[model samples]
Structures are given as structure tokens and as C-alpha cells.
Target: MIKLEQINKYYSLEEETLHVLKDVNFEIKEKEFVAVMGPSGSGKSTLINLIGFIDKKFEGKYLFEEKEITDFSDKELSAIRNKSVGFVFQNFSLIENNTVFENIELPLLYNGSAYTDTKARVQEVLTKVGLADKASKYPKQLSGGQQQRVAIARSIVNSPRFIIADEPTGALDSKTSEDIMQLFQDLNRQEGVTIILVTHNPEMVSYCDRLIRVKDGVIVEEELVK
Candidate 1:
């Protein structure tokens, strides 16, 4: 569903140019659960941002379902991103003051969805992520795992075709992390949402159907385990 060719990202600092990604090329198919593994400075997060349409300054062609999006206008990018992509971050990114229901409802609100439809979608996703009971609770009232679930619910509330998760379980304990992985697995299998996750944990890699390892900003290895 996504492809990148000859991708190169460079940053200029003090008259010195630092290349973040060099000749990075990869493709992710629909409904595929792919894991991106790499050490620090390996450009894993940068690549995710590119795929998620958060970074547009890189030199390369990014095609989503055969349409080149590299030169898409900011408004166009925002539309596509809101409708086609969902994001789960390590920090949870939930609004502290909003209730779980409200946080998950924010996306639909931004998309101009009808109030009734937005309410239903938020409830459905919250239930899907096992956060229905916590709908009225604030972020601070929930545990780390519950907060993460709320974040996941918020991402998928719009039924995005793809999910880009960066260190999704980084702040959770082992058991909670496993639960989150299982939730992602179920989402990919049942909902057919293509999931691309960046993780440093070996255990998380084992849960993915395919693994891609990056070193020095290049994909050095790719393996299909399923």
C-alpha cells in the first residue's frame, strides 16, 4: 500500500550536512504487519515520519496506492493522513484534561464527521481496544496500559487503512506490552489495517509477520517469519 524509492533525507547544521536516510527503499503491502528494528540514529523514526506524511522535505518518491504524494500540498496531505493513516506514539499523546471518550472523538471532530457518527465511532473503537469502561475517565486516572489503549482507540477511530506505531509499548511493562502487541495483531488480522511498527524490543519483532532491520539509515535485512 506504500512504497518509497531512492529516499534521502538530509539536515544542514553549521554548514555541515548530515544524511539521515540514504537510498532507503521499501514497500509495505495491504494488511501486512511489518516491524522496523534498528538502533539509535538508524533513521527508523525518520522513515516512519516520512511514511506517515509528517515529513515532506526528503528527496524521493513516496507512492501511496500508486499515487505519488511527495509533492502533495499540505492541505491534501492532511486530508489523506486523517483518512488513510493512524498513528500510535510511545508517549500516548492523549489530552490530559479530556476524558477517554473525548480524546478518541477528537479525530472525528477534526474530520467534520457528524456528531452522532463521531459518538458511535469513538465508542466502537474504545470497545475494540477494551477501553469502553474507561470512557469517562481522564488520562491521569488510567494506568499506563489503559492510557495506551485510549491512544490506540483514538488512532483507529476513523478506520484508517494503515497504522504507523512508533515505540508503541516502550513505556509499558512486559505483560502490558504483550497485550498491546496482541491488540495490534488482532487489528491487522481482523480489520485488515496494514501496520508498520518501529520497536527496539526483540520480543515485539517476534509478533510481527515480517521484520526489516535498518543500520546506518539503510535496510540491511528483511525476513518474513510467517
Candidate 2:
């Protein structure tokens, strides 16, 4: 469903140029759970940003389901991003003041859903993430795992083509992390949600179908996980 060809990205820092992604090439098929592993300076994050339509200034071709992403206008790209990608982060990124239902409803509202009509969809995703009862609670009132579950609910409430999860379990305890990972696995295996995970935790890799390891702005390994 996604393809990158001869992708290269660079940054201009003062007087010197730094390469961020070097001739990266890969494709992620539909419903696949892929993990990207790399050190701090590696270009995994940059690679995902490009895939998720957040970065457009790169030397390469990106094709999503055979359509060229570079062909879209900024507004069109934003629309495509809103409709085609969901993002999860290490820090959850929920609104502190919004109720769980409110947080999950934001994307639908951005897509022009009426505020009055968002409850059913919000409740559906909340149930999918196992937080149906917590819909009226604020982020501060939830445990870390529940908070992250809310974040996951928010991401999938829009039903994007794929999810980009970057260090999703970083803040939780190990047991909580396992629970979150299991939830992710269930999402992938049962619901067929395509997921691209960027994590430093090797234990997390075990849950994925494939692994791609990056180093110094290059992909050094790509293989199916056993």
C-alpha cells in the first residue's frame, strides 16, 4: 500500500549539509505490522515522517496505492494525511482538558463531522480500545495505560489507512507495556489495522511481522520476523 523509491533527505545546518535519509527504498503492504529500529541519530523518524505525509521536501518518489504523493498540493496533502494516516506517540499527546470522547472526536470534527453527531463514532473506538467506560474522563484522571489506550482510540477513530506508532510504550511500566503491545497486536491481527512502529525496545519487535533496522541514515536490515 506504500512505496518509497530512491528516497534521500538532507538538512542544511549552518555551513554544512547533513544527510538524514540516504537512498531509502521500501514498501509496506496492506495490513502488515512493521517495526523500525535504529539508534538516536538514525533516520527512522525522518523515514516515517515522509511516509506519513508530514515531510515533503525530499529527493525521491513516494507512491501510495499507485498514486504519487508529490503530485498533491499542500492542501490536498493535508487532506490525504487526515484521511490516510493515524499517528501514535510515546507521550500519548491527548488534550489535558478534553474528555476521552472529546479527544477521540477531534479528528472527525476536523473532517467536518458535526459535534452533535460524534458520540457514536467516539464510543465505537473507545470500545475497540477497551476504554468505553472512560469516555467522560479527562486524561489526568486515567492511569498511564488507560491514557495511552485513549490515544490509540483517538488515532483509529478516523479509520486511517495505516497507523504510525512511534515509541508508543516508552512511558509505561513493563507489564503495562506488554498490555499495550498486546492491544496493538490484536488491532493488527484481528482488525487488520496496518501499523508501522518505531521503537527501541527489542521486546516490541517480537510482536511485529517484519523489522527494518536503520543506522546513520541508512536501512541496514530488512527481514521478516520469525
Candidate 3:
């Protein structure tokens, strides 16, 4: 559902230009479970941000479902992102002071969804992530796994067609990380949510249907395990 061609991202310092991504190219199909693996400074996160529409200052063509979004304005990009994409960060970017329910409800609230509709949607996603019972709890009250579930619920509450997850299990222990990955697997299988995950863990690559390896901002190799 997403494609990038000849993508190049450069950052300008005071006297030097840093190239984060160089001629990157890839395509992710609908309902595909793809993993992006690489070492530090590999531009994996940079590519994620570009695809997620959070950063658009790169040179290249980006097409989502055949529509070129490279030159979309900020407002247009926001609308597209809100309607088409979801994000799960390693840090579980929850509002520390908000309850789980509140955190999940924030997106709908910002989108101006009706209160009744938002309530039902939030509850549904919370239950999907197995966090229904923890809805009233604050972020600090939940364990790492639970917090990540909340983050997942928040990400998927809008029923996004694609999800971009950056090191989704990075902060969790091994068991918890496995659980989280399983949750992602189930989401892909049951809901057909297209997932592009960035991870460094080789073991985690086994869970994905396809793997794309990046080095020095380019796709060096790819494997289809399933």
C-alpha cells in the first residue's frame, strides 16, 4: 500500500550536510507483515518517519495506494496520516497523567468524533489489546507490557490501514517482548492491518512474513521467510 522511489533524506548542519537515507526504495503490499532490520544509524527510523508522513522534507517520490504524497501540504498530510496510518513507538508515547481510556480516546477526540462513537471505539480497541480492565489506570500503574498494549490500542483505535512500529518491544523483557510481538502477529492475521516494523532482534525477524535489511541507508537484502 506504500511505495518509495529514489528517496534521499539529507540534514544540513552548520557547515556540513548529513545524508540519512540515500536512494532508498521499497514497496509494502496491503496486509503484509514486513520487518525492517538494521544496525544503529542505518536510517530505518528516518524511513519510518517519511512513510508515516511525520517528516516530508526528503527528495523522492512517495506514493500511498498510487497517489503521490511527496508534495502534500501540512494539512493534507495530517489528514492522510490521521486516516490512513497508525504509529507504535518503543517508548510508549502515552500521556503520563492521562488514564488509559483517556489516552486511547485522545485521537478520536482530536478528530472531532462523536463522544458516544469515540467511547465505543476506545473500548473495543482496549479489549482487543487485552487492556479493558486497565482502562481507568494511569500509565504509571501499568507494567511495561500493559503500557505497550495501551500504546497499541491507541495506535489502532482509528482503524488505520497501516501501522508503523519502531522497535515496538525494545523496552520490554524477553517474555513481554514475545507477547507483544504475538499481539502484532494476531493483529496482522485477524485484522489485516499492514504492519512495517523496525527491529534489530534477529529472533523477532522470524515472526514476520518478510524481512528487509538496510545498511548505510540502502536496502541491502530481503528475505521472505513465509
**Cα deviation of 71 in candidate 3 (Å)?**
3.3
Q: Which stretches of candidate 3 lie over 4 Å from their true place?
A: none
- Candidates 1 and 3: which is better by lDDT? 3
Give the per-residue lDDT of model 3 (tens digit) for 70-112.
Answer: 6688999998899888899999999999999999998887777
Off by over 4 Å in 1: none
* Ranking of all predicted structures according to TM-score, beginning with the best and ending with the worst: 2, 1, 3
Q: What is the lDDT of residue 155 in candidate 2?
A: 87
Q: Count the clashes in each prediction.
A: 0, 0, 0
Candidates' C-alpha lDDT: 0.91, 0.94, 0.92
lDDT for predicted candidate 2 compared with the true structure: 0.94
lDDT of 2 at 46: 89
Q: Compute the lDDT for candidate 3.
A: 0.92
What are the models' TM-scores?
A: 0.97, 0.99, 0.97
RMSD of each: 0.9, 0.7, 1.0
Q: Report the candidate with higher lDDT, 2 versus 3.
A: 2
